[model samples]
Target chain A: MAETKTYREALREAMVQEMERDENVILMGEDIGVYGGTHLITDGLIDDWGPKRVMDTPISENGFTGAAVGMAMMGMRPIVEMMTWNFSFLAADQIIQHAAKLRYFSGGQVQIPLVIRGPNGGGVQLSAQHTHSLENFYGHFPGLKVVAPVTPNDVKGMMITAVRDPNPVIFLEAGALYGTKGEVEDGDNAVPFGKARIACEGDDVTLIAYGRQVNLCLRVADTLEEEDGVSAEVIDLRSIRPFDEDAIVASVEKTHRAVAVQEQWRWFGVASEVAAIIQDRAFDYLDAPVERVSGAEVPAPYARNLELAAFPSDKQVANAARRVLYMEEK
Target chain B: MPAENGNGENGGAEARGEGSVATSADRLVDLYREMVTIRRFEEACQRGFRQGKIGGYLHVYTGQEAVAVGFLDSFKEGDRVITAYRDHPHALLLGSDPKNVMAELYGRGSGIVKGKGGSMHLFDVERGMMGGYGIVGGHIPIGVGIAYALKYHETENICQLFLGDGAMSQGAFHEAANLAGLWGKDGQCPCLFIVENNQYGMGTSVERTTAMTDLAAKFDAYGIEHEKVDGMDIEAVLEAAERLTEQVRETGKPYAVEALTYRTAPHGAADFFEKYRSKEEIEEWRQRDPIGILENKLLDSDAADEEKLEEIKGEAKELIDEAVKFADESEQPPIEELYTDVYSGEDEYTGEA
Candidate 1:
């Protein structure tokens, strides 16, 4: 039977199950073991897996992450948790240079099959430097795949898939969704890359989102039905590299309207790209110009009120949907 | 960990990094041939690029053939070899078909990396050529990770990593080196870092780029056993590779070799010769060219005559010409192919929706 679990718990379970199944499936990151992960994502893993499998490394992202890349090249399935997206910048050279391009440059002889994952997105006063979007930063690379899982089911499934993937994968977990719970497959569940999931079905307008923004978009969809009678279909984009443009286009073709909701800044955000793709491939079906509900273009603030203002919420998504539904320009 | 390698599955011995014994002149000559092939291949690439027969960032390893050939001499059948973008010579020496390498340069499907990799990146995993990386210091960590797998799979294989002087300054090199040293001490590492200190990292001298010009000395900070070798001398390099690889297998320790060599050509065909270095310095390095030294030695030893050398040159030219023709006739990768291989060929995972 499928059991309900939190995002963090589901992630931990995925790692544990994979480690149990394969001996070479090891994890290395900052405080991932006995420290139980800063987000408690790896709680109780050290005792079960021991020091070799669950490594709590030094603060050197470039060091440990590069080492993990090395290990991955040699056929070990290494999962490197960056602790947070903010810290990955320090190891950007290794991630972009070595991990991502190894396969293509090596003439396809080697497989990085390395996953660098951690909490992403800004919320609850995690100010400035700690709060930035990486969709654009890492998405710029060619060989690497960028994934952001929102639901617990997605968390478990995608993590398993990331472990098995031969290329280097950057798995971004929405920090806000760690406590959110959901039901997952009973055993050995794995979700593929480059696929989008439709969270809710609607007809009037489509709300495309990913990561934590799915929850926010779902809330907006509910509000649109109650107040405006606008049926907003929600599309949860799972993979960014092999982006599901076909899904988004198909959704827009049916709805004739599109509103992309993102927790990241609007400028060059994933939402902006989604809107562009919709307009590019499915522009003829559009009832109105696509609108984007994105986080404010500024450093995330430490203050609770300012932090709330920095990111998109249900009100923003609903308003964006309304704008797309109507002839109004935004 | 309770016997973590539960699958009991492993790749070929080449991936495992195993070594084999050799005390014969035939093998030595074969190693020399490998070096000769690399040297000839590099000169051809330089000529091809100058004539607009190639494209992209082409980093040549003309003067450092001995370093690659020597290491491969000691590299057991199961060992792994990874290096930086300056990788044409490495591929040739590691049993990669010179014609295929040239085909790759011409963008042919028959190339070593199926024409996907040009001069900078070439791969042959079955032959244990891990990769030819584009980024300067990027592949060092990858080499270390391969070593980790050798140990993980309970194999006595070693990883031989090649990088240029510029890569040594990259933080990835330092961090990976330190960790390889630490983990290796406890038996989870089997890597050797070979810094091809060709004096310049794209025009800028090592003395100008790094404070510690002694590249081998930098490994001392990471606690890896390191030594300096005359990269031009094939015998010196072979002896060092044998001793260093043995040390790695026995102690599970990491070592670094600073092959003091020089690049005879510009950083790439795109680069103009006058921007960074002086003509005099370039001329001086040319006087001690690895190929010239070998040619002189062969002439003195009577192991062969000038006619044999000419015949070797003729064969090399014909092979390069054939490679170019094959690559020219080969098809470019299809548009659909762009999405494939971004992940492993895992049967359990479906990447395309």
Candidate 2:
């Protein structure tokens, strides 16, 4: 019973407590039942789940996300949304060939447990066709899980493990942190998926990030320990396709330097798979080559200082955490 | 809001001259032995893709076996079926197991997707046959989201889906026919779609793709309810799949039929030299051969002869030669099943950290 809530009211109280403890969940998209979700986070949820479990579809994002992957291949736990992950590139072939390869081409006999969700990167301007970070385009698919939570208690505990994970998740969220806020934790809080939290800890340099670039890497790890005494740390990832990567190689083996950050755009981003998983398993505990930052390969600009120079900033993640801590250079 | 269709012109030659005038004689000899076991399991998947034992691309549903045996013999038992990628006669007419659809076209490990969806994906989904889709109007919004999950599980079950005719100029089939015409305006879309119109998409036809080639009047611009049968007539596609699956299970809505039909091979099996189309328009649709018009309607009603359709084509070539010796003694999956079902719960959700 801790309250606070606002990442769009904890993503609408995690779809109103999983649509009141599942009657096989539901909630389709496109003006999410009576104009409540163009980011109103499913507003008054079709007046408490009516229109047949709050459906309201028709802008046909690949026909209601391929009819929420045919109502999640018959067992129904739907929850589609996609009002923007830049219009989910019009249902990217029913989310990469039928909600991520229909249970390995149906040998596992189907279980899409679909989630989808919406709002992805590029702050406000909404220029390049309603911006999009797409966590490395849905964690470069392979059945898909891809979380990206960022707070308000990890989007209501990872929207209850992407509505009880059977498969297809993607989630993302963060249209400029829907009125930010934080605290959350109420009931049946569910978060598990590939873990990664350590949002503030510190060492000489860790950083990393996730949706809303983990509050700009916790405000650039609090201005690099209050203006350059330098502690850093941060982390936040919160699932990018089952990516805890042992909490990012144990935070670059306890901050022997790393940076990452995102918003999306530095060539194949999610900060280039967190700087190649911190140089593939804390390469001799990194100390240097792991920098990243991202988001300005163009296309998200409609002015306002060219969409604040296309994004990524707290002075470019404090200059990539002062060039991975060696105090600036490479 | 378009619904009221009717202009399906000659509605598939008036449902192939009045739907086989009350057919019987043992369900037209079990629909001419399941359309000669899908033309002998797609001519043994074109000799197992010319003996390399089939791997990847092999579309062939050859002249679309009476639109997958007249709408999977009018579905019903927990109705469901989906298609695209000329799926080996919609998984040998929706019951799969022809040695697991020839060991999922010889990829093996008792195939039927255990061979992880080979020839343009193939699934069984416990006999509801919910897959085949190798993109092309990608499973038409997954058959309007499996008829919106069989009307969200209250089930009077329904979902036909199949695609082709270049997936009716895909925008994922006009956004799954406008959300099965807006969730069938509250009957919660039961879905049917079908289309098939085999006119050619790979070698581009349907009058070079669409100036409104009336693919059942494009589901009357998405208000759904459409028609147009005669897919080389298997009793006018089982009397329009028993009157559109009993009017989509009594009004759960979402229909559309189309059929028309023509692909007598060459959209795969490495599309032979047959440039676009010709050879007398593929010998005039091989004289409307839906198994030679049901063996000339079972010898004009003697109810089958020519040595009983040559002993039902010698028991469909000895059940496709024991499904090609049970897919040449099955088993190939190994390599630790290349990391099982992608991700459904631990195997460390794959991408091995």
Candidate 3:
């Protein structure tokens, strides 16, 4: 059974459910308790769980994030809010040095069941320092599990899976889509990591993305269908590190044409990985080279027009899909 | 001996006020033995590093033996202990098998943490030795978090966080200390910050590193009560450890103790230049060596004679020799182990299948 819920509500419900089920599960972040989360993803949680469980930390990202790593080692499932993914750079040492490598360095003696979640990517013109898409940055580490779920259902379900996983999970939420509503399953509907969800199936060409870019791909799929009479399959790569290579290969094997999309800069982005994987695995299929639709290589500007120009748009994705489909770009 | 002539006038036992727990002669002897064992073990490590038997950066807790030995004496079951890269002494004091510790330095399969951590990251969780972190000030927050969890779980256990004098400059230390103090107010953080002010950080002395040389007083910024102790004196450290550990356990509040000590050996095994300070300065500190002071105290108190001290030294040598032999004989970790332990579940490895 399922009900329609906003991405924020679904995300909060997933954490609340897990916290209720497991006493070890707790939330910690700046302004999460008394101030209600900056994004309100954890709003009203302090009243239910109290200050101990819903901890409000100081503006020390390195300290609290490292503390969460320690708590996770001691068997507490701490979900640390990074306010935004941009601030995570301050705690990158803790996340990369300690949280990621602790289990390996400790010879499997400890497990960091830590979930560091926050809004990622720029949409509301928060400018340079405040905006970032860090999936590729974190996914490069071997010990971390990186996932960016766009849908409310996937947000709720993936969060459940992330909480239960015995490794550190980097949850990249679509900051722009917290108010976006979708069908969310009730109760423990945990979606497993390392699997791709085929958002829309088609036979001609495949459109691949994750986070908010998944919605952009769907929109591009509609435009492609109406304008070029081309069928575009949309694949949401929900997980990045434990990537669904088989799903990508299978989708490419069927459609024979693909366009990898991301809101990150072109250099060393997730799209680059996707393109490399496609060429390595599904080269036998007679299709054109995979096209990568990525953001312009520049820091996000404060102006709305400049910001919109910086990110991947429907037109850019559609043209990329059209180019792969061997059709004229509109 | 130069040590006998220098620092010999410093009074022992009667110097500090008597606490409820009177340290017995037997306990003093035991503490001396442990300190000597650590000294011998560290000396062996230096030899092993020079011979290429032990790889990576080798940081020995040579002259700073008494600090760990004294502080760890109050370690109770379930209390967690964590420290920086110079960690063999902490692990050994917490009862980690010396063979495994030596084997780890040798990069062997049967080593503690399975040869992955080397000298910098020794972890014996079963013995409450959380880990030996490599980064300066990085483990502070983790230690505070462990204390928070201890309180969260409604346990009387506390976490003993060992940091170097250099780490005080890092933002992580200040941030974690603030959190410790904040949480301690509500009886939710039972973290004991033990700053081992061992004179120098690598080659930079504490005075050169910070304008404020008093590292313990720095804790005052976080509102945590703190004190200083002669890290060279085992009795002083033991006295402070027993009383402070009890206070933290009872109140679940964070506390700080700056143990002023020195590393008589070179910063690293490869740091042979000795250019940071003069040879005369080294000689001066050597006269006040912790082991030498403890030996004088034992001799003056009639706790043991020269023969007893020699026997203890001989025993420590034999034990360390055995550990070295075991480490040399141990096997390297299997190739498959490279892919293991990256992640914990069914899909344990993310690399090539």
Candidate 4:
């Protein structure tokens, strides 16, 4: 009865299960139906669910996005997908202004349980137009719960939870990990927002990240433990908006040194915000300067080599760790 | 008027009552009066802004009065309304104390939003007047999102979201629209998207900014039922809104209404109207001004004498004068109040030093 699956498959299962359980759940995006998604994340879904539920849209961001807000306002749990996080910028008004302000402005009269899910970050050499990390953009908003699930398990769990939660949730999945395979839990299980997961625990230094970067951090942790005898505690930030800073502070209390890592650039980036929070909350607990490991501050290039160099890698994380642990020259 | 017209009925055309109940001339006259009051109020506000009495970015919605008044007439006391920064008319139409609204423009503490938000950022949560947003097309999703909550609460209420043609171009409009369309087809969405297409988005005209000349046609993509209405004509706007809003309230489906109006003033007060539009164009729209049209209707019907119409105008002037006095006398919002209402600090324990 059981079968092995990819991370995207697990997410599909979560959506399928949630949709089946609740008639109110629906999905909408470009090419989500007949096109089966630009990635196979929604493959076979349209065939199973049909057009009414697995709705594809015309190339009109303002119209459909506003319609989604209207739907969420009406009470159906709609999961809206932008093909990429870059496309979401087109609908930023609906996301930030409308979805975020309705509840407070209505004085707690409504909840927009709408989820905008899509691939975020760069590595596929899609170049500047498609590649973007909107974690900070959405994370800056108040009425939204911004989620970045790295694992197949969390992707399933958090998405289901986001669909069921009372507020609007921005479910960000990394493009590079869509087809990546891993073990995942079965039916109906959901992860709560604002809660971080410890992918692999260690005590030497804390490695903080989320989405696809968490796996990269874990790989670096493995490299550090095997080669340099440095055990890195890897933390998945998960929900970026209501961030799980408690877990980060608790880990930093034990590890003393921290390296904030992300696929986005270092300047005024998501990781910088994290580093600031860590410094403010656990300033005295720091054994050294709160170091940051992020991508170079440049537009993501289309070529494979430049694309790889533009984003943070496991080796760069190791180098950051070496610098933090005083194992090598900066 | 047909009950099943536009998006007024639930359960297809069959699951509902007839489209609209005809109204007596008294009710129509009252609506006309409300529109007139809004016209005179904005004209005075403009004069005040120029005279240095009101210090803020005042967005006078001179031509788009009918959209708010006509749409809001369908809403019961408990129903909600939210819009972008050009919100004075909406506040006036939504039964807010006009004095408080005018005072808010004067930066008086007693004003709506407690004078924290000036012309472009008025908020009166008590009246379900969510706010006047400063960001272009920023408040659309939030308005629809709140509508989601209202329906969840099981209240047979509808939330009306009014935005400009400019906001219709934002991606959130599409995202929120897709959501509304899908949820609406299932009969769970109680949102009404009223695009007050006042011809321009600041400096750009709709023809320049968007591909679609008729914004109502934009709804066909989302599969939501909608149309374009003459915003200057109060009767037509009200007739259309009454039908559409009731459908949303009764069936829990969403509707879109594009009230095609033109702004007689500059997008905001700062720009000269001559830069984008011709003075003749403004003159033409002014001749068909909602107030003038209503006044003519009252004269034709003999609902009230010309003297009574003048008295109502005087009454509106007195109200504004009271508001100006109240705002002048009332102190500005104390600086310490800034930290308040930023968030619901109740459950959050930040452990601040």
Q: Per-prediction TM-score, please?
A: 0.88, 0.42, 0.97, 0.77
For all candidates in order, the CA lDDT equals: 0.79, 0.80, 0.91, 0.77
- In order of the candidates, what TM-score does chain B achieve? 0.86, 0.37, 0.94, 0.89
- In candidate 1, how many Å is residue A76 off? 1.8
Docking class of 3: high
Q: What is the per-residue lDDT of model 3 for residues B1-353, given as tens digits with 9 covering 90 to 100?
A: 32222222212333221234566666777888999999999999999998999999999998898789988999999999989899999999999989999999999998999989899999999999999999999999999999999989989899999999999999999999999999999999999999999888898988898999999999999989999988888888889999899999999999999998988999899996378988988888888798898787676665656777788999999999999999999999998888889999886656666
Docking class of 2: acceptable
| Alpha-carbon DockQ of candidate 2 | 0.30
Q: Residue B261 in candidate 1 has what lDDT?
A: 85
Q: lDDT per residue, candidate 2, A1-330, as tens digits?
A: 888978898888887888898888888887887878777888888887788888777776877788788788888888888888788887888888778988887777887889988888776887887887888877888998888887888888898878988888888887788888979889878889888898888888888887777787888788777778888878887888778878878877887888887877888777777777777777997768888878888789777888988887688789878876767622
- The positional error of residue A197 in candidate 1, measured at the CA in angstroms, is 3.3
Error of 3 at A79 (Å): 0.5
**Location of the lowest summed lDDT over 10 successive residues in candidate 2 chain B:** B7-16
Greater TM-score among 1 and 3 belongs to 3
Each candidate's number of clashing pairs is 14, 2, 0, 48
Write candidate 1's Cα lDDT for A1-330 as tens digits: 799998988998898888988888999988888888899888888998888899878777988888888788777889998889999999998898778767765666777878899999888578998887787678878778899999999999999988888778899999878998899877788998889999999999999888888888888888888888778899999888768888999999999999888888788888889888987899899989988888888878898999998888777777777777773322
Model 2 C-alpha lDDT per residue in residues B214-303, reported as the tens digit of each score: 888878877887888889888878888888888988899988888888888788878763787878988898888788877765665556
DockQ, candidate 4, comes to 0.18
Off by over 4 Å in 3: B1-21
User: What is candidate 4's local distance difference test score?
Assistant: 0.77
> Candidate 1 or 2, higher DockQ?
1
